[model samples]
Target: MENEEILKKSQKEISVEGTEDFPLVEVPESERKGFWSISVVLLGFTFFTATMWAGGNLGVSFKFWPDLILLITLGNFLLGAYVAVLGYIAYKTGLSTVLLGRYSFGDWGSKWPDFVLGFTQIGWYAWGTATIAILLTKLLNLPQGWNIPLMIVFGFAFSWTAYVGYRGLEWLSRFSVPLMTILIVWSMTIATKDAGGLAGILGIEPTKNMTIAGAITIIFGTFVSGGTQSTNWTRFSKTAFSAIFGSLIAFFIGNGLMIFAGAYGGLVYQEPDIVNVLVKQGLIFWGIVMLFLNIWTTQDNTIYNFSVAGCNFFRTEKRRYFTVGGAAIGTILAILGMYNWLIPWLVLLGTFIPPIGGVIMADFFYKHKMRYPKITKIKFQKFNWAGILGYVAGALIAKYSPGVPPLNGIIGAFVFYVIFDLLFKLFRINNDHVVEGEE
Candidate 1:
């Protein structure tokens, strides 16, 4: 009885220490209203959503190789729904993804997810910035290698915006969102008119170039990385309804519009780049505006999320430094010609992101019964071997799966984590009872 009392006391002390070690990010309570708007904008700027729609539509129209529109659409829709559920949890808890992971991954174990999330964001930032630079160079008829200089400028610009923290990012969203919407609508209007009509494009022959699996892969691959950063924006939502509505509008609606517009443009001009297609169709100004808006909105969110993850990792208040630092690195990489390297990185990111979602969803919704510890009194425990092993196994299967569906990563990860977690509990591994209010 005496030993039990001592053990309980020790647990309490550790919990207190953990709470002090990692304090919740503080935003003024009065700023809550703005957070909702910010969340909407952040979600709106997701590049993957736009890219998926555009790429998928293009694949569907050209009769390139295989047929997979339905499969791809299904995968994208399902994944979006799953991500929205996770966003709802984040909104309710007001915790970043890293903190949320504590429940299942333990304290230290959560770092792995953080590392993956951070690296992926950096990769995305680099790719987006480089793409924009290339576009600018081509549009202006700049000299060869002009992209190097433009990339540097873009890096600084985005990093500085991120340095201002959430406020700067919110401001970016305010401008970029409206511009993107206008561009999308305008592009569609012009493209549809030029193509003879939307109906004509839709009635075109079913393309056999892109397979169902390939389309699914493109759709899923686009947003897989965004899953890790969902909480950064969602935590600001004032209520669950806001989160769901905002995510649906920003993800589904925005993506669908972009896809339809891009498809129409492709049919009208046979151009893969939507902007180039529009330019060829005599809408150069609108094309440039669209490209700029899309790149800006997406880059802003990427930089902001990357900064937050960096701050968490270093446990420092110098968020601006990391933001600028990362941007500089990204810019240099772009200039040095590293954007091509992102294709493989994107593949890796997609493969890993789904497992994280599965593990996190399982822990919050199923294992913990949807109870999150109070932010001010949270605690961290040792590494969770079950989660680690499960994640690894999922990644391995996703990486090595022989010509499986493109979404094999998500499927494999979700399955591995759920099954392994249950098996670990069945074997009585790390089955410590969590004391209510202790952490």
Candidate 2:
């Protein structure tokens, strides 16, 4: 009992950081998390309502149920593979994406990823806050006039969780992840019953026809950006195996569940959001529970991502300021309905982010021979033109030359960054490598 109390107390100490900087310095092995703990948080992050929304859209978009299931499973596996690479690096190095970018994009050039990652997260924060508010109004049959205040209330409330940092995230996840999973399964069961049982659900047909590639893209696109950012959680993994398996399970199984829920709900009820479907079936209590927990999980993480990005960009310790500021902007945007308007823009922006991953992979794996220099004594470059160009080239390819834009961008950037960096080394053009830190 004494040992158990000590363990609980230790976790409580680490669980709520409460207005401190992200542990940007290298993490000691003792500080890392094992598979189950890290898996819960990572899985929690992907249990997003947006994914349900995407799945619902796919349900109508594809003509066959088997095809939708295949697409979602396959697409998420690809996503899992994409994030697993970074998760391994995070575990190996004990570094966040922002810190890792310092090695590839240079000290100052790395801020571009910080900005994109941070800025996009802020957009999502607002979208989520707005969505929850909107859904609440619908669920409770409240007056529409309450929407703005609701956004502010939820936005600020959720932002506080990010302010406390990953511990708070972990705490919330421990309680919410399991509960939310139960709610999801319960809701799906209820939905299945309402649709005239399993056979009836199986017989539901898609109202529209879309290409397999397009369908897969939507599934992949639902959380691709979040998948890239998952290193934030996976960085705490105790070992590379833990990181890989934890992240893979979250991405493939956790994410796949969300997609299936949305697609199933959308097909049977013609509503993409399962929250609405629940309400339609006179399960308002469950609707409200799922709605709040679902949106809260994603929104807090969105704010936390922005805070880390802000810290990287400004080199400041006042993460709370960024959290508040980002939440405020997100609230305003939600008030202005950026939720709907910003979606396509956000998806387009997601394609550009994977290049950063590609560049980082090349730099760490091949250029540095898979050993990151010690951060406290490292002499990494202030700017790496080759990496920057490769990232730009990848974005251009994604935008213009696309066969599946996101994959195109990632592959294009990976190949280009590798080749270009080699050229730079051969010709000594930019001399992008860091000087010896010890010297």
Candidate 3:
């Protein structure tokens, strides 16, 4: 009787402490989410102002009929397929990117991913906070001095949903996704009419030139980091189909929409900023509303990613606390001006981040054979040199290779991971590998 009572009390304490979201373990089947819920949240995460800006750049560089359309379609298809595979892995493992890192990157090697993924997410959070504030100040004609103050207000305010965890994200997405869709479609309609429909759109010449490879790089790099971390939510999927299909809807269709909208605005008014495009369309009121909702949805998700990565890095279950801490740190960066660093930041993410995903996929599919032992059942090395070396090889290729950088990084990491893993096994260097298990 006493033993039963002790077990009950222990379980009760765990339930209270880690209920925000399971930062260190699998989400129970009972807590899994359906397709619609996962779709909306993922959609909300993909919809962002920066992605449109990337599209706008592409718009000015490629013709609409074939080049722009083809690039967007092809690029997003690859992006969607990549994230969907990761989503499926997430579903099978019920783990976030960082937790999965343990099996692949090793116990301490996982911290490298923890730091890389965490920094990228926080950088994005800072950029978003600064961007909204600057845009708001400009649109409202507020004093220049108000920029820092507004950033401070928004930096913390945007994290409210994230602080509440997955349920908070889902609730916000359910309300905001529909409205955001309507606004984007409405603005696109205006842009099409202003440009004189398809015929006119086709007639507009690209003002600049970009190589196909470069264009694709921009398209893929735009969200590689977010897609890499999307498992933070996709792990909640109720079924493998829900995880894969929902990722496709969000990364392919949802992100594609943002890009197309920005490209349309650029083609029509020589503007890529959607809010600015709406303003020119005489919908300033709706423009403000769209800006707020667009940034808020993505901002919350970005910070949430940071918190998840942070939890894994520190090996804590206090995800909510990290959410707040991350927001505060992002606010400080925003005040210091992360907005101006967008282009270089994207380049860095494009080069360095994809390899992490590649190593993870290789680790899961090859080494573990798509089945990971329970966390408690396995002992991890301080570093998994195969995964680490594989990532290094991939990142180097991404930086120096001439073809599509993100794709190069992913394939390079995957192939090298297999090669290195084999070498390690051949030499008995990896004898202490993760414990064997069946799915």
Residue 49 of model 2 has an lDDT of: 84
* lDDT (C-alpha, whole model) for all candidates: 0.63, 0.79, 0.88
Please give the distance, in angstroms, between residue 133's alpha carbon in candidate 1 and its true position after superposition: 1.4
lDDT string, candidate 2, 27-123, tens digits: 5566678888888888878888888888888887764357877888788898889889989988888888888888878888999999888877877
Model 1 segments more than 4 A misplaced? 1-31, 34-39, 47-57, 60-75, 203-208, 341-346, 400-408, 431-439
The local lDDT score (0 to 100) that residue 406 gets in candidate 2 is 71
User: Between 2 and 3, whose TM-score is larger?
Assistant: 3
After superposing candidate 3, which stretches have Cα over 4 Å from the reference? Answer: 434-439
Cα TM-score per model: 0.83, 0.92, 0.96
Q: Which regions of candidate 2 deviate over 4 angstroms?
A: 1-23, 342-346, 436-439
> Highest TM-score: which candidate?
3
Candidate 3 global TM-score: 0.96
TM-score of predicted structure 1 = 0.83
lDDT of 3 by residue, 151-254 (tens): 99999999999998898888888888888788888888888899899899889998877799888888888899999999999999999999999999999999
lDDT of 1 by residue, 1-439 (tens): 9999999996775554333222245322333434458455655566332473345355445542223335434655755675677778777777677667666677678778877887777777887788778777777777867887788888778666566655566677776667777766776677667657856655556443654554555556666667556677676677787666666665555554555455555555666465466556666666566677677777767766666667667655455666787787677667766656643554566567767776777677766678776644654565766566667776777677755333565556556667777887788776333545753
Q: Between prediction 2 and prediction 3, which has the larger lDDT?
A: 3
Clashes of each: 10, 1, 0
Candidate 3: give its CA RMSD in angstroms: 2.0
